[model samples]
Target: MTDQAHHETTAPASVLIVDDSRVSGRKLAKAVTALGHRTELVSGGTEALGILGEMPFDIVLLDIVMPEMDGYAVLIAMKADVALREIPVIVVSSLDDEIESVARSIELGAEDFLPKNFEPAILRARMNASLARKRFRDRELDYLRDIDTLTEAAQVIEGGAFHPTELNLASVAARDDPLGRLAKIFRSLAEEIYDRERRADLTVRTLRGTLLVIAAGSIFGIAPALGRLASAREIPPLGLAFWSAVVAAILCLSFSIGRSGLPRLKLRDLRFLTLWALLLGCLYQLLTVVIAAHVEASLIAMIGSSRGFMVFLLAALLALERPSLQRFSGLGLGFAAVAVVLLVQGTGEDNDLLWIACALVLPFLLSLHTLLMSWRPRHLGAATTVGIMMALSALFLLPFAVAQNALFLPSLSFGQRELITLALGASTAAALVLALDLVVTAGPVFSSQMAYSQTLAGIAWGMLLLGERLSPLAWGALVFVIAGFWLVKPKRAGDDFRITLRMKGNG
Candidate 1:
C-alpha cells in the first residue's frame, strides 16, 4: 500500500476513534495519523460526542458496546445532528458476527462495520475505503448542486452561443465516421429505456405481490377466528380484537413480502438472513402446531403471531436497515393504547396474558419482514415470489389445520357469515391500505404522527361502527407514542427528510 503521506494532501481528512480500550484507540489513532490524516482518540462515545460538537471530523470509528453511551446511541445522536450526519461512521467493535447488533448499527446510519481483531492491513484498507467513500459522496453532492452550471457551460460558449455547431463543423472537417456516432447514440437511448422499464416492472410486481400476500395471509389468520365464531354461535365481542394478533402478523409478513420477496434467496448476499428466515419459518410452524394442541386456538394464534414479530425483528437486524425508532415507538404506543381499551372492555381472565405476548412479539416480526423485503433480489419478480411463498406457507399449515380439524367449514346465519367474510376481506383490504400508506409517508413525516393518525382512525371507526369505548389509558398511550415519534424527527438541513445516501460511492 502507498504511504498515507504520499497521497494528495489538498484537504487532510479527519478521523475520530471512539473506544473504551486505550490500547485499541491509540493503535487506530496511529494508523490514521500514519496516512497523513488528522486523528483524535476518545475513550468513550460521550467524549466523542463532545469532540464532535467542537470540531468537524470526516469519519468516525465507533465501538459498539461502549460504556454509558454505546455505539448505537452515539450513532443515533450523530445522525440527529445536522453537522455530524454527513460524516461517515465505521463501527470498529468485537461484535462483528452478531448479526442483529450489526444490522442495528447499519440502520442507525453507520456507513460500515469492522472487528477489533482486524489485521493491520485490513484496518488500513477499511480506513482508506471509508475516506474514499466520503470523498466520492462529497463530490457527488457538489456535482448535483452545480449540475445546471455544468450543463450550461458544457453546452454554450463564453458568449452563450451554442458550442454544438462549432463541434459539428470540426467533426465534418475531420470526416468522422457517421455510422459509429449513430450507433453510440442508439446504444445510449436503448440502455436508458431498458433501465427505466426494468425499474417500473420490478415496482409493479412488488406491489402486486404485496397485495396478494396480505390477502392470503389475512385469510389464513381470520379463517380460524371465523370458524371459532361459528362454533360458539355468538357475536365475537372483540371482532377486531380477536383478529388483531393475526392481522399484525399478516401485516408484518405482508410488509416483508412487499418490501422483500418471499422466495428471495441470496446465498452470497446476507446468508445469515436466508438461514434465519428458513429457521424462523420452520420454528413458527412447529411452535404453532405444538401450542395449538395444548392451548386455546385464539391463544395459540396470538402467541404464534407474536413470535412471527420477533422473527421480523431478527430479519430487520440482519438486513442492516435502520428502524425508525419514532415509527416503532408509535406502533408500540398505539398497541399500548389498544391494550388499555381491551383491558377495560375485556371480561376473560386469560385475554391480557395472550395480548401481552402478542404485543411483545410484534416489533420483531415487523422488523424481520422489513429487512427481508429491503434486500429482495432484483432478478426475481416480487409478486410471483411472494405468491409462491404464501402458497408454500399455506401448504405447510394445511397438515396442522387438518389434524386439529381446524379446517371444518362452519355453517352460519346470514349475519354471522357476513361477519366472518368481512373479517377475512378486511385483512386483505387493510394490507392494501398499509402498502399505500407506506409509499405515501415513507420520508420526513414523524413515525409518531403516522401512529397517532392510525390510532385515532381505529378509535373513531370502533366508536362509530362497533360502539367501542376508549379508556383513559388509551389516551395516555396515544400521547406518549406521539411525543416519542416527534422527538425522533430527523434534524437535517432540508425540509426533505428522506435518508438516502449517495449511491455514486459504490459506483
Candidate 2:
C-alpha cells in the first residue's frame, strides 16, 4: 500500500490493468496511479473488454495466463475491433520463458510484453515506449487521411463538372467566353491526374517485380533446406508432403492459365509457337525436381537458370517487336550475370549435366508461353489465364506424375506437415505464378527486370537462411545484373543519343 501511494505522482496517464488475482490487480493499479496515471483494474479479459467500451484508455496491461478469456484472446479481440485496435496493450505475465505466448501476443497486436515482477523503472520505460509508438501510428494515420482527402479532391476536379446534358448545353451557351478557360483548367487537372496515376503505376510495377524476385529467391532457398531435411529423414513426411504440394501448385497454375482466356488460338498459333517454348517453361520445374532428387546443383542455381531463360525469352520477344539496342543489351547483361554466378559457384558433384541441360531448356518454354500470352490483346482476364494454364499444366504433367509414383497420397501420420506443404505449394506457388503472369503480360521489359530482382533476392535469402556463400564472381555478377537493368531502362530519343555520345566519349 505504501509502495502504491509513493508511486502515484507523475503526469496523469490512463491505463487498464487486467489480472485474475484481485490483490495483484490492485497492486498494479496503485503502482500505475503513483506514476501520475489513472489506472482501471479489471479481474479478467471479459471485464477488460467491458471497461474498454465504457471509456477510452491509453494502454492495457494484460496478463497472459488468464482464465476463460486468456490474454491472447483479449489481444485478438482488441485487434479485430476497429475502435479498440489502436489502444496500446502491454502484456504482464509471470511466465518468464513464454516465447510462444510472447510471440503470439505480439502477433495478435500487443504493443509490449513485460515480466510481472519487472522493476518500476523498467515498467515506466516500456509504457513510455508503447505510448510513443501509439502516437507515431496516430500521426501516420492522420497523414494518410489528409493525403486521401487531397487525392479525392484532385480526382473530382480531374473528372470535371457534373452537369445534366440539358443544363450543360444551356451553360455552354450562356458562358461561351468562360468555356475555353474551363476547358484549359480541366485539361491541366486531367494532365496532373494522369501524371500521378502513371507514377503510381510505375511504383506498383517496380514493387511487384521486387516481391516476385523475393518470393523466387525465398522458394529457392527453402527447396534445398527442405531437400536436406528430407534426405536426413528429419522431416520425411514434410518432404513427401511438399512434393504433393508442388504438384498441386503446378495443377493450380495450369488451371489459371487455361482459364485465362488468351486470344483465340488458331492453327497459326503453332507456326509462331514452337513446342520448345512451351516445353521450356513447363518442363524446367519437372527437371528441377528430378535433379533436386538426385543431383548437387544448388536450388538457387536452378532458380537463377529458370529466371535467366524467362528474361532471355522476354528480351528476344521484345526485340522482335521493337528491335531496340537497349532490349538486346538488357538480355545480354541478364544472361552474363547469370553466367557469372554459375561460373563462380561451380556445379556440385551431384549436379547431373543432363539435369542442368533440362533446367536450362525450361526458360525457353516459359518464355514461349509469356510471348504467346503477350502477342496480342488478352482475351482472358489474369485470373482465368492463370487458372487455365495451371489446369492444363497439371493435366499434361499428370501422366508423368502418376508414372513416377510421385502423385501418391498416402495416409499421413503428420497432418501438420501435410498442411504446411499444401499451403506452401498451393498458396505460395499459385500466388507467385499468378503474379508473374500478370508481370509478363504487362511488358517484356517489366518481366526481364523482375528476373534480375528475383536472382538478387534468391542470393540474399540463400546467404541469410541456408548458409550459402556467394563468391566474389557471384557478387560481380549481381553488380552486372543491376547495372544492365539500369542501362536498359526505356529512354527518350534525346536521352538515348546523349547516352550513346557519352559511351563513345568514354571509349
Candidate 3:
C-alpha cells in the first residue's frame, strides 16, 4: 500500500457487530475504530436484524454459534433483503468445521470469514477490500439504471407516451465523474418530452371515460363529506383513516385476486410496496383526515376540487404529461378559484394556514404516487398495487390509532352515530380506491377530473347537512372550479382511430 493511504487510514464506514461475547464485540469494535470506522454492537442475530431493518450498515460481522438465529441464519436473511443484500457481511466464529462453515456462509452471501482471535491487520485489509468491491458494484448498477431510463425515453420519441414515466432527477452540475454522464441523459429526456408536447396530443382512452370520471369523482367526493361528519361526531382523525384504509385494502385485494393470482412476494417487491404505502397510505391519508377536520368546508371544496389541476401541473413539470392550451387554461381557472376562496374566507380560524398546508401536502404526495405508479412492474396489476398500498398504510396507522385510543372506540361501545359514520367512511373509502384504480388504468387525465365531484360534494354536504353558508367570493370561486372542469373535460374517444383512417385515405 502507498504510504499516504497507509498513513491516512481507511474512510470511515459504519460496521455492525453481531456477537454474543461482550469481550469479542468490544475488541472487534475497538479495532474497527482504530482503523477510523464507526461500529455498532448487537448481542444476537435477531437484534441485528431489527436494527438493520431501521438503518443500514456498510458491513456486518456475524458470529455463527449464537442461539435461535446464528450467523448462518442471519446471512440468509440479509441476502433475502433487497436493501441490505448489497451490504457485505463477514462471519466471525470458531468451530471445529471452520472450513465448511466459511464455505456455507459464502454461499449464503457473506464476503469473508474471520477467526474469533483475528489478527488486527488482516481484519482491516478484508473490510477495506469488501468496501471497494461494493462501490464498484454500485457504479455498475447506476449505469444500467441510466441506460434503462434512456430506453424509456426512446419509447416516448416513438409516440408511445400514453403512460409516460418520469425519470429520477438530481442536480448533476456539481459532479465531475462518470456519473456526470447521467446529466446529459436528463437534458436529452427533457428536450424529448418538450418536443413531443409540441407535436401532438397522446390520449389514453376508453368508451367508459365519462362514467369512470364521475365514479372517481363520487368516490373522492365522500372524503370531504366524511371529514365534516367526523368533526360533528368529535371522532379522532386517526381512527377514521385507519378503519377506512383497512376496508379499502380488503376491497382492493379482492379485486386484485380476481385479476391476478396471488402474488409471490420478493424482497425488492416488499421494500418498494412498503415505501409506497408509507407515503400515500400513511402520511398522505393521515394528513388529509387532519386537514378535513380543521378547515372550512368552502375552503376544503375549493382545494379538493383542484386535484386535476394539481396532477396536470405536476405531470407537466416532470415531463410526463403533455403541456397543452386546454390543460394550461384549466390550471389557470383552478388557481383563480383558489385565490377567490382565499379572499372570501380570509383565514377564519387561527389554524387555517395549517389546514391549507396539510391539504396541499396530501395532494402533492398523491400526485407523486400517481407518477410513480406507471413505473412499477407491469405484472403487479393496478388492483394489486392499490391493495398493497392500502394494506401497508393500514398497518402503519394502527399503532398510532391504538396509542390514541381511537381504534374500535365506537364499535366496542355502540355509539350509534359514530358507528354509522365509521361504517359509511370505511365502505366509501374501499369503493373509492377500487374505482380510482380503474379510472387511472383507463385514463389518468379523466381520472384526475374527479376533483369536480369532490368540489361539488364538499359544497353540497356542507350546505345540506351542516347548514353552512358561503360568501359571495367563495361562491364566485365555485364558478371557477366548475368552469375549469368544463374546459378540461374528458376528450372524446377515437382521435387515434381518426388518424389511422386519414392515413388509409392518403395511401
Candidate 4:
C-alpha cells in the first residue's frame, strides 16, 4: 500500500522555484526533488520568467517579496500572456495567514498559497493536483487547435482549391474524436469528385473526335447527289432544303426511343431548338443548295468547308474550346486553299464573289448550330435534336416550296430529276444530318475537314453529271487540306484529346 501510494505521488514533474534568497530557493528545490519532482531554482522573477520561456514547467513556487522583480510582478506578467498563464503558481509566503493577501495572490492567478514553513505532505498534494489539471488543459488546447485547422480546410474545399493529401492525417491518428473520421471522409469525397470530373472530360473529347470523323465522311457521300439534283432541275433552294430535311428527319426520328423525348423540353429550350432548326437546318440548307446551283459544286463545297474553322473560332472565343497553334495553322491553310480555288478557277469575278459570299453564310450558320448543341441539355439526345431540326426544316419549307411550285414532283411525276432529290435527301441528307450530330460534338476544326471530303465528291459529280473540272491549283489546294489534317491530329491520349479523327485521305 505504501509503495503504491509513493508511486502515485512521485510521477515526475518539472517545477520552478523562484526566490531572491539563496537559502529559501535551495530549500524549496531540495524538498521538490525529494518528492521525485524535478526543480530549478531562480533568484529573481526575471530569471524565472526567462527559464519558463525556455522550458515547460507544471508549477512555479514563487515568493511574494524579492529585490528587483517581485513574485506579484512575475504573476502579473505570466497572467498577461497566454503561453505562461496556465503554469500553476503557488506563492510561498508567511502572509498566507492573512486572508486578504491570499485572496489577492489567488486573484492574480496563483493556484494556491504555500506557507514559509511548508509541510512536505501538503506540498505534495497541492503540487500533484495542479499538475493533473495542467495536463488535462494541454490536451484540450491541442484538440481545439486541431478543430480550427479543420475549419480552414473546409474553407479551402468550398473555394474549390481542395488538395487530396493536403491534410496531415497523422495529427489525428492518436485522437479519439469524430472530427478525425470526418477529415478522412472529406478527403475521400474530394478525390472521388475530381476523378469523376476527369473521366467525364475524357469521354467528351473522345466522343467529339468520333463525331467529326462521321460527319466528314457523311457530308462527302451526299454532296454529289445534291449537286446533281440542284443543277438539272428547277426546284427552288427552299424546296430542296425542305425535302432533304423531311427525308433526314424521318430516318433520325425513329432512333429517339428510350432517350429523353423532345416533347418534354422546357419552353425556352424548345423555342431555341426551333430557332436552331430554322437557322442551320432550314435556312442554311436552302441557301447552300441555291448557291450551289450557280457556283461550281466543288467550289461551293470548298467554301462551305470553312464552317468547321468558323465554329472553332467561336468556341475558342466562348471559352468552350482551347485555342492551339496546330488548330490555328490548320484553319489558316484551309482558308488559303479556299482563296486558291477562287483565284485560280473562279467563274467570273463578280459572279464568283457573289456566290462565295452566299456559301460563306452557311458555315457561320453551321457554327451557331454547333454552339446550340453544346449549350443544349445533354439528355435531349443527338438523334432527337437532329430529327427536330429536320422536321421543322420541312415544315418551314412547305409554304415556300408551294409558292415556288417545287414540291413532291418536279413536274408532278417521279422523273430522273425528282428521283435524284429523293435519293439525295432520304439516303444522303438523312445520313449527313445524323453524322452532323456527332460532328457538332467533335469540334469545328475537325468537322470542317468534312468539306475537304465533300470537295472530292463535288468534283466527281460535277465532272460526271455537270461536266465540272478542278483547276491545277485546286488540286494543290487539296494538299493543303491534308497538311491541315496533320496539324490538328494530337499525338497522345488524355492530353485533352483521346479518340482521334485521322480523316481517311481522299481516295
Candidate 5:
C-alpha cells in the first residue's frame, strides 16, 4: 500500500474534551492531539452535546464539575439517545473526587475514569483501549447490518421478484474473513439464479404454462359432474363437502411433509386461514354440491364463468384495481351474459331458477377466496399453503358434520361413490397446485385464461360424462362470458402473489 493509504488505515480516533475550565480543556486537547489523535475542546457539557449532535466522535473526555450540565448529566443524555449511546465516555476527575466520581460515572454508563493529572503513558493506554473497543463495536454493527441485507435479499428471491444488484454485499465481501467469503459465495449464487431466470426461454415457459392451465381447467371442470354423481347416490351435500376436504387435506399435507416438513403456523395466520375455509371449504362447496343436484352441471359451470368478473368487481371495490374503459366494458358484458343465463336459460324446464341463483354465490365466494390469497403468509410452498387451508376447512366442517350426523365414510368395497369422492378431492388438489404453478411460471394474466378452458371443459364434461346438454342461448352466453373475461383481464399482471409477513402477538 502507498504511504498515504497506510496512514489512513492507522488513523487516530476523534476525541471530544469537555471541561468547564478553558485552560484545562485546552491542555487535555493538546495532550490528546500530541498522541496522534484529533481533539475538540468544549467549555461545558452543553457545548459538547451540541458538537456531538452535529458530527460523530469516537470518544468523549468528560469533566465532572461543569456549569449548567455536568459530566454525569451529559452521560445520562448520551445514554438515552440511541445514536450516541455506544460512543465511549472517559470521565476526568481530581484526586479528591476520583473514587466517588469513577463509581458514579461507571454507574451512569461511562466507559472509564481518567485522573486530571495523569501520566502520559497511562493516558495513552486508556485511550488506546477505549478506541480499540469502539472500532470493534463499529465493525460488529456493520457486519450485522450487512447480514440483514443478505436476509432481505433471500426473502425477495423467494418471493419471485428478485433483481440483479439487489444484494448489497460488496463491503462485506471485501473483508478477509469467513463472513466475507460467505458473502462472496452468496452474491455469486444469487446473481446466477437471477441470470438463469432472466435467460429462461420465453416460448418454453409459455408452453409449460399453457399445459398447466389446460390441466388445471380440465380437472376443475369435472368437479360439478363429480358432485352431481355424489348427490345422485343420496350423499348429503355437507357430507360430500366434508369428506372431499378431508381427502384433499390428507393428500396435500402428506406431500408437503414429504417435501419440506410441516408448515409453522402463527396465531395471526389463523384468521386468514379460517376465513378462507369458510369461503371455499364450507360455503362454496356446500352451495355447489346442493345446486348440482337441482341444476344442470353445464349451466352451473356457465354461471361459474363469471368468476373473473366477480374478482374484478371486488378488486375495484377494495381499491386494489384501477378503473379502465376496456375493463369496465368487459365487466358490463360479463353481467349481461350472467343475466342471459339466469333469465333465458334458468327459466327452462331442465334448470331451477332458485338453484341457479344459488350457484351465483359460488363465484362471489371464489372471488373472496382469491382476494384472501394475497395476504397469505410469506415463504410458504404452494402445497404447504393449500394443505393447511384444506386441513383447516376439514376442521371447520367436522363439528357441523357431527352435529348433523351426516358424515360420509366409504364402504369396504371402495365402490363408485368412494371412487368419485376420491376423484373430487384429488382433482381439487391437483387443480390448485397447477394453478399456483401457472401463476408463478407465466404470470397471472396468462393463468387467468384458464377461465375459458374451465368453462369449455365443464360443458364438455357435462355432456360426455353426465349426458347434459346446453341450450342455444346458453352457448351464446358462454361466448359473451369468454369475451367479458378477455376484456376484464388486466393486460399486465398487476400485483403478483403478495407475500404478507405478519408478526404474532405476545400471547
Candidate 6:
C-alpha cells in the first residue's frame, strides 16, 4: 500500500464541538485535541451545521440546550440529510437535564449522550469507539464498490469483445488484501484470453476475407459478358456505365440503409469518394465497356487478372508492403498464366494491339482502386461506402450521358434488356462492396489475389453463357492460377511455409 493510503486509514479523527457555553466548548476541544484528534468548535447549532456542511468530521459533540436550533433540532436536521446522517453525534447535557436530554437525543438519532463535565478518560473511550465504527463503515463501502467493479469486469469478459486494459481493476488490484490478489489473477486471465481471442479472430478474418475475394471475383467476372451483350444492342459506353452505376447505387443504398442507416459523408470524405467514383465508375467503366465490345470475354478476363501483379508492384514501391520472394513468385506465376491465356488462345481481332493496351489499363485502375480502398476512412462501412461511391458516380455520369445523347433507359416492363440491366447492376453492387470489405479484412495484396479467381470465373462464365471455347493450353494455364492462389494466400502469424519446407528438406 502507498504511504498516503495507509495514513488516510489511520489518520487522526476530526471532532466538532457545538456548545452554547464557550468555556465548556474550549474544554472539550482541549481534551479532544490532547487525545491526538482534530477538533473544530462552533458556538451554536446553526454554526455547527454550517461547518459540517462545508467539511466532514468523525464525531460531533452537540450541547443539548443551545439558543436557536437546539441540539435536538440539529440532530433531526443532520439525520434528514443523507450525507450528514452517517457521522457519529454525541449530545452533551448537565446533570439536571441529563435524563430528558439523553432520551430525546437518542430518539433524535444521536449516537450517545455525554455529561457536560465529562472526564477526559471517558471522552477518549467514547470518541475512540465512534471513530473506529466510522472507519469500519467507510472501509465496508469501499469494499462493496470494488466488488461492483469486479462484477462489471466479469460481464466484460462474458461479452467476448474487450481489451485487457478495459477490465478497469487497477484500483482494487492495488490493495494489499485477498480481494486484491483475486483481481490480479483475474486481470492475468483476462490478458491471456484476450491474446487467444486475437489469434482466433485473425484466423477467422483470413478465411472470411478469402471467401469475400472469391465472391467479388465471381460477380465481377460476369460484367464483361454483360458489357458485350449491351454493345450488341448498340448501347453507348457512357450510357451503359451511367445506367449500371445508377442501378448499383439504388441497390446498395437500400441495403445500406436497412443494415447500417444512411451514410453521413464528411467534408474530408467527399474528396476521396469523388476520386473513387471517377476511377471505378467513370474512367474504369468507360474503358471496360469500350474494350468489352471488341475483345473476347475470356481474353478480357485474362488481361484483368494482371491487377494482382500491379497491386503487388505498387504496394512494394509505396513501402506499404514488404516484398517477399514467395509472394513475388506466386504473383509471377499468376501473371504468366494470364500471358499464356492471352497469347495461346486468341480469336479474330483478339490480336488488336490498341484494344489489348486499353484492356491492360483496366488492371492498373483496379490496382489503384484496391490501394485507395485500403486508405479509406475507417469509419465507413463497406455497404455505405460503396453505396455513396456509386451514387456519386451516377451523378458524375449523368451530365456526360446527356451531352453524348446516349442515355439508355430500360423500360419498366421485365424485358430482356431490363433483366440484363438489373443483373448487371446487382452484380456490380455486390462485387464492389465485397471487394472493399476484403481490403479491410485482409491486406491489400491479399485482397488483390482475387484476380486469379476472377480469371477462372470469367472463363467459365464465358463458356457457359457465351458459348466461348478454350484450348488445351488455356486449360493448363488455369492450373497455374490455382497454384499461385494457394501460394499467395494468407497464413497464420509466425507461419512460414517456405522455411518449413526448407527445414524438412535439410532434415
Give the Cα error of residue 444 in candidate 1, in Å.
14
Candidate 3 lDDT over residue span 288-380, tens digit each: 666777876656766765566667777678876566898668656766776666566565653467667677765566556656654555557
lDDT at residue 487 of model 6 (Cα atoms): 67
TM-score of each predicted structure versus truth: 0.34, 0.44, 0.49, 0.56, 0.55, 0.64
Better of 4 and 6 by TM-score: 6
Considering lDDT, which of the candidate structures 3 and 5 is the better prediction for this target? 5
Best by lDDT: 6
Model 4 C-alpha lDDT versus the unseen true structure:
0.68
Instruction: Quote the lDDT for 221 in model 5.
Output: 81
Q: Which stretches of candidate 2 lie over 4 Å from their true place?
A: 1-200, 220-282, 299-323, 327-338, 352-354, 372-388, 403-406, 415-424, 427-434, 437-442, 456-469, 472-507
* Residue runs of model 1 more than 4 Å from their true location after superposition: 1-359, 378-386, 409-422, 425-469, 472-480, 489-507
lDDT score, residue 410, model 1? 37
List the lowest-lDDT window of 10 residues for candidate 4.
Answer: 491-500
Model with the higher TM-score, candidate 3 or 6: 6
Q: Give the per-residue lDDT digits (tens) of candidate 4, residues 95-154.
A: 635587789899899988888788998888888777766776777788888787777655
For model 6, residues 343-408, the per-residue Cα lDDT tens digits are 777645554778877788888898999999877877888778888898899899999999999887
74: Cα error in model 4, Å: 31
Clashes (N, CA, C under 3 Å) per candidate: 12, 41, 0, 2, 0, 0
Score each candidate by Cα lDDT.
0.50, 0.56, 0.68, 0.68, 0.75, 0.81
Model 3, which residues run further than 4 Å from truth?
1-207, 258-267, 334-351, 409-446, 471-507
The Cα error of candidate 4 at residue 105, in Å, is 25
1-507 in candidate 5: lDDT tens per residue?
667444443478889999988788888888899889999888888888899999889999999988799899999999999999999999998849578879999999998999888888888878877887777788889888878877876666665554546557787788788878888898898767655544444445656766775688778888888878878888877778888888888898899899888788788988877887788877877777888888778777777667766666666688655657786676567557656655654545867777888888876676666566656677777777777888888888888888898887779999987888788888888887777666666544345556545665777788888987666665666577556555644334222322222334513
The number of the candidate with the highest TM-score is: 6
| Cα shift from native, residue 239, model 3 (Å) | 2.7
